[model samples]
Target: MSDASPVHFIAHFTVTDGDGYHNYEKRFFPVLKPYGAKFITFDDNVTVLEGEREAGRTVIIQFPSEKVLMEWWNSPEYRELAAIRHQATTTFSVSVIHAIPQR
Candidate 1:
C-alpha cells in the first residue's frame, strides 16, 4: 500500500482497569493532533450483528494517510500512553484498514 492511502485504526478491547484506561484516553487526543487524525467514534456497547466475534469497547480513528498514521503509531508519546492501555484492557485487538482507491 502506498503512503498516500488513507487508513482507519479500529480497536476492540475490554477494560479491566478503568482508571488506567481513562488515563490513556485523557492523554490520547493531544498526541493525535499533530498527525491529522480524526476521531470517528467510540462505543462501549457494541452489538455483534453477525459472526461469533466478542465485542467490547470499540474505537475507530481515521488518519489522513498511512504515513501519518505510522508516524503517530510509532511516536514515543503514543507508546507511553499505549502501555497504560495494555495494562488496562483485555481481549485487545487492533486493525489498520486501508481505504479503497477512488474509481
Candidate 2:
C-alpha cells in the first residue's frame, strides 16, 4: 500500500480490572483528538465465525494514514494510557490493518 493508505487499529482483549480499564476508556477520546483519528466502534460481544479465536471486547479505530497512526501509537501520551490498559486487561491481540489501495 502507499503511504497515504488508511489504517485501522484493531484490538481484542478482556478487561481484568474494570476500574482501570474504565479510566483508560474515559480519557481515550481526548488524547485522540489531536491525532486525527476516528473511533469507529467498541463491541464487547464479538462473533468469531471461524477459527479457534476466542471472542472478547473488540475495539476498532481508524486513522487517515499509517504514518499518522504510528505517530499516535508511539507517542508518550498513548504509551502512558496503554500502560493502564496493559495492566488492566488480558490482551489477545492488537493489529494494524492497511486499507486496500484503489485500482
TM-score of each: 0.89, 0.91
| Candidate 2: clashing residue pairs, number | 0
Identify the runs in model 2 with alpha carbons over 4 angstroms from their true place.
none
* Per-residue lDDT of 33 in model 1: 96
lDDT (10s digit) by residue, model 2, range 1-95: 78887899999998899999899989889889898899999898767687776656988999999899999989999999999999989999899
Tell me the RMSD of model 2 versus the true structure.
Answer: 1.3
| Best model number under TM-score | 2
- On lDDT, the candidate that comes out on top is 2
| CA lDDT, candidate 2, residue 34 | 96
Considering only N, C-alpha and C atoms within 3 Å, which residue pairs clash in candidate 2? none
lDDT for each candidate structure: 0.87, 0.89
Q: What is the model-wide C-alpha lDDT for candidate 2? A: 0.89
- List RMSD in Å for every model shown: 1.6, 1.3
Worst 10 residues of 2 by lDDT: 47-56
